[model samples]
Structures are given as structure tokens and as C-alpha cells.
Target chain A: MALTLETRDLTIRFGGHVAVNGVSCTFKPGELTAIVGPNGAGKTTYFNLISGQLRPTAGTIFFDGADITQLSAPLRTRAGLGRAFQLTNLFPNLSVEENVRLAVQAANGTHYDMLRPWMVRRDLIARADEILDRVALGNRRQVTATALSHGDQRKLEVALMIALEPKVFMFDEPTAGMSIDEVPVVLNLIAQLKQDASKIILLVEHKMDVVRSLADRIIVLHNGQLVADGKPAEVIASPIVQEAYLGVAPGRSAA
Target chain B: MMILSGDPPRSRVLSILLVVIILALAATPFLFPGAKAMNVAAQICIFAALVASYDLLLGYTGSVSFAHTMFYGIGSYAIAIALYSMGPVWAAVATGIAVGLPLAALLALAIGLFSLRVAAIFFAMVTLAVASAFQVLASQLSWLTGGEDGRSFQLPELLRPGTVLISKSLIGFELNGRVLTYYLVLIAAATMILCLLRVVNSPFGRVLQAIRENRFRAEALGFRTVFHLTYANCIAALVAAGAGMLNALWLRYAGPDTSLSFTIMLDILLMVVIGGMGTIYGAIIGASIFILAQNYLQALMGAASKAAADAGLPLLPGLLHPDRWLLWLGLLFIASVYFFPTGVVGRLRGAGSAKH
Candidate 1:
């Protein structure tokens, strides 16, 4: 597998606190890589740095073998990095279809057409409908994004991400606020992205079962540093990973 | 009707009403045959275009700019000075537009590029500061702008009020310069409204509305948000300059009070608020209602004051004087805001969806 995204000594600091520090990794195509850590382990911060939401204090990010360290968020998005935020970020006032349609339009490069009516773009609308149906929000296409249930908004977020046709997908806690039954639906959707042989999927998830079932490899972080990186079972059996999660040595019991 | 079949029935009805209003305005000078009525009708046309252009920024793109009137003033002065210096020819009018539009676009670009870096409220404040500075410059540049007096110059023979287009009466009114000028304003305003309608329905317009709804989401979706906003600002400035040029030609003057005054900006704000912010048709409805009220309210107040004085009530007449009509107008504005929060068009469209 070729490397699709790579980071070298990526570092970001907020005043006296170091959110992400000197973490380096390479993501390969067709790999479902799960990044897991204890609370405040800088998982989301690292995701933000890769997605261009936060600039690294000192580091270089290479996407598809090109340096994109200074690219802004939108530029990075256009450069084929798609991100679904932890909190459902959407155009709340627009309809669900409009939300996806805008993403599709952005992907199609029709966002700058100042004279033609948007409805005239049947191809974009059809693509938007297909993406909506895939995300299972076709029935509620006319509903405002804010009016959708929490689970549906998450799905809409996924729909928006998929519409971008990204080379790499970065999902920051896709199931953060989802209910129990809704979890499998999102996990299934994330799992489906593996069908594309040239795409890389990075998931930041807290659900251990989801990581165990879907991830091809597991990377663990503790205190803003990568602690373990290997197959899921191997990483899970590592003492450092066990100590980071259990807050003690593997054989020690809580008093 | 077929083109509007996809729209809600209410929108269809509103569109028809707008066409009717445009036709009514076109027939105003012929039907009334009075100079005062013709003047009022011309004002409605000019302001309808002006308010719609302002909505492109404030309503669609979600940018509040206080420098709008400054652009309008620039267009007026550009034409006035050109006509004054080069003599009244069609070429001079074209030159004025050539000079004025780019000037407005450049100013808008500079302001948008610099001030757009700030937060929304801060951007408005920056525009206010810049607009005030531009007003002072207009007042001080006496040689070009005629300073406080402003400039009035010769118009082309076809535009002059004395130039008769037809020998005989048409519909019981002579086809003279006033009528020709009225139709000129009418055609210009109507064309602008049509072009703007096309723009707001375009994909570019959707991106603007998207930016207004959630800029972060828009940018995250791969939109160059700042560029779209700056483009919108330039288009708004260009349309506003068109309206200003028509106004200067109609009035044959472009003074600080007429063109660059903040009161015109306030009037535009009030029109957008009262008519409805996001809907393009709101400009027409709002401008007509406000301008009509402004024209007649003083006369109504004067009549009441005279009636009171004739009835032997001194203090009541003073309170009812025409000079205090603004107090009444202010109250009306407050009442409109309180009652119609979303504006007249918003009310007409209903509560659930007003963005269209």
C-alpha cells in the first residue's frame, strides 16, 4: 500500500499546554486505521491538525506526497481531505437536500456559477440524491438540518463528507452522541468506505468494539504521544496501552 | 407560470404582484400627468433598485456595510462631473459609468479585503468609518463635486425635459423629456431587478446564502468563503452605482444630501427591514411604501396643523406641525419592527421558511 498521508514531528501548543506533541505517522491507502486513547489523549486535536482546522506549531503534513503544511481548511478540503466533525457541523437552516447539494456542487466546481439557476444543474442534484439515499436520509430530504434527529444529523454529516469525493476521510468521533441502535448504522457506513481500494479512512473512536471490528490496524496515544502501534490484538495486549487505560500496571488491581 | 411551477403558490402570486407593480410604475406619468406624482413614481423606481442591490450584501451574503451610500455618491458625482466637464453627450454618460463602477468596485474590494478579516459587527463599524471619511472628501472636493452645493449640469438633448419625442399626445400626455426620462429610469430599474433575480437563484447565490447560514460549514465544504463574499460586495456596489447614475440623471443634481447622506442608508435599511430582508421583491414593496409615506405624511401633518389652528387650539397645532413628521415616521418604523419582525414579505411567505 502506498502512503496517502504522512506527518513528521507534528506539534501544536496552546499557551502552556501541549495538545499534540511530536507525533509522526503514515497512513496507507485501503487501510482502516483506528486511533484510540484515554480521555484528553489529544486524539481529536491530532485529527484537527491533519484536517487543517488547527495549524501545527511545528511540523510538516504531506498529502499524496506533496507538502501541504500551510494549506487552509477549505484549500485542504479541495485538495481531497474530507472531515466529519465530532459535533454535527451543518447548515442548520438549509434543507437536508440543500446541505448535500452544496457539498456536491462544491465537488463539481459549480459553486461559482453566478448566472445559471441551481435547479438547472440536474446532474449535481441527481448525485446529491444518490448520496442522500445511501446515507438513508432520502425520506427526510426536505427537512431542515436542525430539524433532524441527532442520529440523522450525524448521518447528514457523513453524507456531506462522502459528497466531497475525498481521497482521505477523517472522522472525529462519528458516533459521539449517537444512541445505541444508531451506532451500527454509522459503523456500517464507515465500514463501507473500505470498498474503495485507493482511499484511506481514519477513525477517532472511543467504542472499543467498533475499533476491534472495523480497524485494519490500531494506533494508541497516551499523553499526546503514540504509545503503541500494531494489529488490534497485539496493541490491546501491550502493557503501555493497558496501563494507560487501566491507570496501573496490567497485573496490578485497584485498591 | 410554467417557469414558476416549481415554486410555492405564494411565491407565484408574489411574482405576479411584482409584475403588476412594475407595470403600474411604468404607466404612472401617463396616468397622473402631474409633475409631483411623476417625481414620486421615479423615486420608487430608483429606490427599488437601490434597496435590492443592498439586499445582495445584507440579506444574501450576510454582510452589513455602511459604505453603500458612498458608492451611490461616487456614481452620482462621476456622472455629474463628467457631464459638467465634457459637455452633455451620450459618450459622457458612458464615460461616467465607466469611471464610477470601477471606482465603486475598487473601493468595495479594498474594504472587503481588509475589513472582512474582522468579525461581522467590526466590519460594519469599519465601513461606517470609511463611509464618513468618503463623505467628508466629497464635501471638500469642491472643484470636482461642487462641494456642499453638489453639481448639476446639462443632459443630452433626448434626456432634457424640453425635448419632445412625439408631436401629438399619446394617451392624453405629451411624449416629452420627463416621460422619456421616466421610461429610462423604468427600463434601467427593471433590467437590474431581472438580472439580480437571476443572480440570486444561481449556484453562486446558494453559496452566498450558505455562507450566511454557516460560514464555517461552507468553508469546510470547500468553498473559498472570503472570495465569494468579496465578489458579492463588488456586485452589490456595481448595482448600487447603476441606481445612483439613474438618480443623478433624473434629478439633474448629485448633492451630498441627495447621494452621500447617511439618511439614504438609513432609508435603505428601513426599506429592507420593513419589506423583508432576504426576498428581492421586498425592496419594491418597502421602497414604495416608505417613499409614499415620506412624501404625503408631511402634507397630512400640515393639513391637521391648519385644522387645529383654525379650531383655536395653538399648542395642538404646534404639536401637529409638519416639521415634526419625522417623530411620527419614527413611531411608524418602531411599530413596523414590533409588529412585523420578519418584515412584510416575511409575513407574506409565512413563518417556517423565509430565506427564498
Candidate 2:
């Protein structure tokens, strides 16, 4: 695996409070990296910076050796950076399939066709169907997005990201609001992305079990600074990580 | 037969209804055989095109613009000025179109580029301010716009009301200039409607709908939201300008009352709401119904007033006079809004789905 995305000295400030400090990190292809931190530890803000949702006050982001720190969110998306929001954001009036179809069309550069009927794109629809079924939303394809349950909306959000087929996936709490029963369904779906050897998956999660089970590497942040970065076991075992993040003594089970 | 069966019954019914409406519009002059009827029909055609153009921005793109009539007035004034300066020839009409469309496009582009940076309601306010300014300019610039009186000029021979295309009558109706003008309006309106339908059903239209639904989601999915909205605005202005050209041709005048009035803009908004905002077919239905009611409501009120006067009710006659027709129209609009909150087309579609 090679380094596919790297951020150097990334920092963002809101007035006097620094949300994301000058932290440097690298994400490699074929690796699932979990970022875990306390509530104000800047985990989600770091994801926002990499996905171009927020501009860094000081830093540079390189994607596949190309500088992308200044790219707009849509242009970043076009350059193969896909993201799913913490909240379920979708077109409420459009059907589930139509929502996925839009993502597919955006990925395929077919959304700009002003003369041809969208229904005529058989390939896009087929791809949308495949993604829908993969997310277990095929039966509810015709239902409007807002009509779905919270868990299903979360699933649809992932389905939208999957349809984009991006080289990098930045998921901000994929199972944030899911019911206990629904959480594993989303987690398993995300865990399946590990099969793709060329894709880089960066996830911001608070669930320790999920991070331990799915993460190939774990990065822990404290007070907007990187406190630990290594394999899941090594990072979790570090006395500094245990004291700063886990609120537990070393050699004790934090979970 | 297979292809015929392939279409859902609702769509088949809708298509048939559309054809019927088109045919009715085409034969309105012959069927009614009166100047008032011809004028009403032409008004319907022009406003339908205008309202449909407005829908592209208001409904599909989810933008509210009060400056739509400014573009409409531009079209009318451009044609009027061109015909007045040049002679009544084909070249004059060409000049009108050439000047009107580009001017409208440029104005739309500038407004869109500037106002699109603001919030949605702020954009509406900006357009309102600019539109009011344009109206004032049109009124003050007497040399160019004929001030409040507006400029009336001679049309080409073919489009003039006196020029007869045929020496004899056809189907008991004379093939005169009025009939020729009616057909020209019909053709323009129908073409505009068809083109708009194509644009709305295309992939580009889908993106507009997505943006309207959730702009942030659309942007996150890689749409250039401002750019798409600006382009949609330009298209809307071009179509509206076409409607204005038709209005100038039919009326043989481009007065402030006819073209640049805020009343016309209000009427457009009313039509879109009454017909259904996002449904393109709603434009024709709304325009036809509203125009017919506006034209005949006064006459109906006058007749009622005469009856009341003959019945020795002086106060009743005064209250129900034709001048008070707006009160009746206001009540009717209120009732329509109450009954059809989503507009007539939306209610009809809801009913159709419920039955299914």
C-alpha cells in the first residue's frame, strides 16, 4: 500500500479557539484509519478539512501527490474525495433510487446533459439499483427519502457515497444516530469496503469496539493535537493515549 | 398497439388532454369569432409562455425573482423601438429579436451573478429593487422608451390587422391579419412550451430539482449550484422575452401598462401558484383560467349591476359595479388557494394517484 492522502501542519481557528491544530498525518491505500478523540478533540473537523468542507488556516493537503488544499468542495468531490455527513442530508422530495441515481450521474459527468432525458440512462439506473440493493434499500427505492426511518436515511447516505465510487472515503460518524440494532448493519457495510485494495477509508468514530474491529491503524487526538498514532493495540496501550483519551490507567481495559 | 399499451393510462390521458387544449387554442378565434375572444386567446398564449419561463426559475430552480417583467418589457420595447426607427419590414422584426434577446440575457446574467451571492430572500429583494429602478428608467427616458405613454409603431404588412392573407373567407371566417397574428402567437407559444418541457425533463433539469430540494446536498454531490442557477435564469429570461415579443406584435403597442407594469408580474406569480409551481403544464391552465376570468369578470359584474339597478336597488348596483370586479377576483383567488394549497395540477395529480 502507498500513501494516497497526506495532510501537513493542518490548522483551523474560530476566533481565538483552535479547532484543528497543526497536526500531520498520512492515509494509505488499502488501509482503514480510525480517528477517535473526545467531544472537542477535532476529529470531525479534521475530516472536514480533508474533504474541503472547511479551509485550513495553515496547512497543505496532498491527494495522490497533487495539492488539493484550496479546491472547493464540489471540485474536491470531482477529484475522487467522497464524504457522508454526520447528519442525514438528502433530497427529501426525490425517491431513494433517484437520490442514488443523482450521485451516480454526478460521478459519471452525466448530470450536465440538458437535452437527454435522465430516464434514458439505463446504465446509471442499473448502477443505482446495484448500490441500492447493496445497502438493502432496493425494496424502498420508490419511497421519498424523508419518509424513511432514521437508520434507513443513514443507509441511504452511505448509498449516495458508494454511488460516487471515489478513491477516498471520508465518513463523519456513519452510525452516529442509529439504534443499537441498526448500528451493526451500517458498520458491517462500512467494514466491507476493506475488500477494495486501492481505496483509502478515513473514518471519524467514537465507538471503541467498531474502531478496534475495523481499523487497520488508529490515530488518537487530544486537545486538537495528535496524541497517539499506531496500530490499534499499540495506540490503545500507550500510557499517554490511555491517560489523555481513555481516562484509564495503562494495562487496564478501556472498553 | 404494444407501444400504445406501454404508456400508463394516466400519461395517455394527460397527452390526450394536452392535444385537446392545443387544438382548442388554435380554433378559439373561429369558434368564438369576436375581437374580444381573439384578444383573450392571444393573451392566454403570451402569458402561458411567460409564466412557464418564470417557473424555470421559481419552481425548478427554487429562485424567486421580481424582475421577470423587466425582461418582458425589454422585449416589448426593443421590438417597438426597432419597428419605429426602422420601417415595417422583416429586417425590423429581426432587429427586435436580435436586440431584445441579448439585452435580456445580459441583464439576467448580471442580476444572477450578483444576486446569487446573497441569500434567497435577499436575492428576491435585490431583484425587486433593480426591477423598480428599471421601471423608473423606462418611465423617465422618454426619448427611448416613450415614457409612460409607450411607443406604438407600424408592424410589417403580414402582421398588420388589415392585411388579409386570402382573398376569400375560409370556413365562414375571414383569413385576415388578426387570424394570421393568432396563428403566429399559437406557434410561438406551443414551441416555447415544448422546448421548456424538454429542458425540464432532461438531466440538467433533474439537477435543478435536486438543488431545489437540498442545495447543500447537491453541492456536496459536485454540482456548481450558482452556475446552474444562473444558466437557468438566462434560459428563463430568453423565453420570457419571446413572450414579450408576441405581446408587442399582438397589441401593436408597447405601453408601460402592457409591458413593464408590476401588475403583470403579480399576475405571473398568481398564475404559477394557482396552476402549480413545478408542473410546466400548469402554466397554460393557470393562464387560460386567469385571463378568461379577468376578461369576462367585468362583463359579468356589469350585467349583474344592471339587474340590480332594474330591480330598484341603487346601493346594490353601486357595490356590484364592474369597477368592483377585483373584489370578486380576490375572493375567487382566496377560495382557489384554500382548496388547492399545492395548486390545481398538484391536486389533480394527487387525485389521480389516490384513485390508482
Candidate 3:
């Protein structure tokens, strides 16, 4: 498999506390990988470091065989890496199409074009509409992003990231705050996104069912260290995973 | 296909609105009946441009620096000094912009980097303090600034006719006259408005708006927010300096009392708030109200003063004094705050937009 993004000896520390330890991993192109851990397992910290939101104390990241460890978030994003926040970060006041249009603008490097009206540009608007439709948000295009239901907002967030046409995508708790019924909808979208063999996707999830359902491979993290890495079934069946999840030895039953 | 083809959507509407307004303004002097009406229209144009410059920083970027009047003062003083030295009007105007822009940029950089660390009310206070300090310095520097009494600058020639004919000379074409000054102001104001509109729609403007919405996100996106903000401030200063130069030439004088004064800040803030803080035309609406209200109130006061003297009665300052106009202005502010939180133009725009 082709490596889209690779971290080498990555470590992130906050003064006396370590959030992400020296654990290296690579996200292969055309694959969706899940990083699962209990709360405070530094999963999001690792995501932030990889996404250029946080500077790792000791680590180097490579994207598409080029070093991008020191690049800024926007630069990284422009270089074909897109991210979705655990907390929704959509532009609240703008209409759904407008939010997607900003992303499309950013990707097109036309943030400076002042003479022509954005709407008059049929090409960009069509692309924005295409991405919105892909995320099942074509119907909500005219509505302000703030007016969207929580599930619909999540879909719009995905639409924004997709609008970037990134080679690699990072989703931090995409299913957080969603109802059980809403979970399947996002799961189906994620499943569809993962089918693109040219795309690399990283997800941070706490739901074992989601991890089992969608992730091709699983990376288990505990106390900022990679505890297990293998196929989903193999990693979940590992003794270390049992110890971390059940807080006991594999053969022992917890009271 | 990409999204948002050339630039942002609202900017398109703004450009169209700007063209229509500029045409109306240029035609005002001709449309109006008399020289006095033309002069009044010219004054309206000048204040509108000034208020628009203020909005560049306050409305778009969200950096409310109270020292905007300092730039206005700098431009006034620059014109005053140049005109005193018998400088050309073009030279005075250029010098005013050159002097004002760098000073305002430096001030903006310092204020943005330092006070931004403790934003909102604290940032406002810091700006107010700097403005007050500049006001004091202006008063103390009697030699250069002409302290409280003000310094008069003589007008240079408005027109250079080979020989003066008896009949065909209008006041503006006949050399040193207020009509010529008014026309000059009208031209300057329109040009400034156009330039400012262009700058506000540029890529720099988008970055500034992004910074205003979310500083952390903008910073994370690798935008040096402070630098962008300072550049905006400098542009604002340059525009304000143009307005100031035109104003000084109109009045033919500059005074320390005129520069960095708190009352000037109050006027600009009121104009911006009344127009709509973030919208471009908000400033135009705000400035019109400000200039009109002041003129109307002063006229009313002048009539009361004449009435009191004619009746041979002790004149009450409340009815006749120009200072009492502030009471009415204060009431306008109170009413604006209570009724039209979005500003007069903004409120109207909002209502009009709601129809869609």
C-alpha cells in the first residue's frame, strides 16, 4: 500500500504531562484507519499534531513523500490534507452553500479575486453543489449552517472537507453527539468515502461497533502509547486491548 | 469546478452600489440650485468618505482603535504646515497622506499586538488612552501645531487664467474662492471612496475578515493577523488623511483643538454605530446624519440667538449656545442605542433584506 501520511517518533508533551508519546504510524492510501482509546488517551492530540494544529515536541511527518511537519494548518490543508473538528467549526452565519464555497475558494486559491462576483462563476458554484450533494446536503444549500440539525451539520462539515478534494482526510469524533439512528447515516457516508482507493482517511472513534463496522485496520492507544495495531478483529481480540477496555487480564472477569 | 468564482458574493453588490453612489455624488453640485447647497453637499461627501475609512477598521476588521482621529489631525496639520510654507495643493495632499499613513500604521501595529492580548473593553481603553495622550501633545506643541487658538493657512490660487475677463468668470473659475474648494473636496472624496472599496474587496480584506471572526483559526491558518490588521489601519489612515487635507483646505486652517480631540472620536463612533458597524454604506449614512444634524441644530441655535437679542431679553445658553447641540446629539445616541441597535442604514437594509 502507498503511504499518504507517515509519522516518525511523534511525541507531544504539555510541560510535565505527555499527551502523545513516541509512537509512529502510517496511513496508507485507499484505506480508512481507526484510532480507538478510552477518554484522555491522547487520540485527539495525535490528530492535532498530524493536522498542523499542534507542534509535536519530537516528530517528523511526511505527506505524499514530502516533509510537511512544520507547515501551517492552512498550507497543509491546501497541500491536500483536510480535517473536521470534534466540535463543529462550521461558519455559523453563512448559508450552507456559502460555507462550502469558502472551502472551494480556499482550495482554488481565489481568496483574492475581488472584481468578479462569486455566484457569477458557474464553475465554482457547481463544484460546491457537487460536494454538498455528495454529503447529502444539496437540499439544505439555501439554509444557514446554524439552522441545520446536528446530524445535518455533521454532513455539511464533511461536505466542507470534501470540497477541498484532499488526498488525506482526518475526522475527529465525527459521530460524537449523534443519536443511534444518526450513527448509521454518518457510518454509511464514511463507508462510501473509504471506498475511494486514492483517498487516505484517519478517524478517532470511541464506538467499538463503529470501529468494527468501518475501519479496515485498528490502532489501539493507551496512556499515550500504541498498545495494539493490526486488523480490527485481531486488535480487538488482543490481550492488551482486553486489559485496556475491561481493565483486567483477558482470562479474568471484572466484578 | 471551484466555488465562489471570482470573489465573495456581497462584494459584487457593494461595487455596484459604489458606482451608483459615486455618480449621484458627482452630479450633486450641478443638481442643486445654489452655491450654498452645493457646498453643503460637498461637506456631506467629505464626511461620508471619512466615516467609510473609519468603518474599514471598525466594521470589517473589528479593531476599534479610538486614535482614528489622530490620523485625521495629522493630515490636517500636514496640510496646514504645507500651505503655510506656500506649498502647492497637490504637494500638501500627498504630504498629508505620506505623513499620516506611516504614523497610523505604526500606532495600529503597536496597539494590535499589545492590546489585542486583552481584547474587547480593555483594547478600547488602551486606544482611548493613546488618543488622549496625542491630544495633550498636540496642545503642548504650540510652535508646530498652533495650540488651542488654531493656525490659519492662506489659500493658493484655484485657477490660473491668462487674463481675467469681466463677464464669464464664475466664483470657482475666478481664482481664490470657496466654490473651488468645494469642488476639489467632492473630487477627492469620490476618489478616496473608490480606492477604499477596491482595497476592502481584495484578498487582504478577506484575511482581515477571517481574523475578525476567529483570531486563533486565522493564526493557525498561517495568517499574520497583526500585520494584516496594521496594513488595514494604514490604508484607513491614508483615506482619512485625504479627507482631512480636503477639510483643512475647505476651512483654510488647522488647530490643536481639532486634532486627537475626544469629541471627534465620539462623532466618528456615533457615525459608524448609526450607519451599521460592519457594512460599507453604513458610514455614508452615519456621516450624512452627523453633518446634517450638526448644521440643522446650529442653524436653529443661531435663529434663537437672533430672536433673544432682538427682543432685548437675557439670552439663555440652553436655547442659543452651539454647545447645547451636544444635548440633542446625546439624545440621538440614546435613541440609536435603544431603538436601532444595528444602525439606521443597517436597520433599513435588514428590513429590506427581510423581504427576501
Candidate with the greatest DockQ versus the true structure: 1
TM-score of every candidate's chain A? 0.95, 0.96, 0.93
TM-score for the B chain of model 1: 0.91
Better of 1 and 2 by DockQ: 1
Model 3 lDDT tens row, B50-115: 888989988888887787787788777878877776465666656655766576667666776777
User: What does chain B score (TM) in every candidate?
Assistant: 0.91, 0.92, 0.78
lDDT of 1 by residue, B19-111 (tens): 777788988976777889989999999999999999988989889999899988888888999898889899999999999999999999988
Residue A122 in candidate 2 has what lDDT? Answer: 84
Per-residue lDDT of model 1, residues A120-217, tens digit only: 88898999999999988989999999999999999999999999999999988898888998787788888789888799999998887888899999
Please give each candidate's TM-score. 0.94, 0.94, 0.82
Tens-digit per-residue lDDT, B1-356, candidate 2: 22221212244444565567678888897788878888999999999999999998998989999999999999999999999889788899999999999999999998888888557897799889988999999999999889989999998998776887775555556788778988999999888877777677777888999999999889889887887788888889999999999999999889899999999999999999988888887788789879988999999999999999999986999988999999999988999988998777777777778786
Docking class of 2: medium
**How much does candidate 2 score in TM-score?**
0.94
Docking category for candidate 3?
acceptable
Q: Which TM-score does chain B of candidate 3 obtain?
A: 0.78
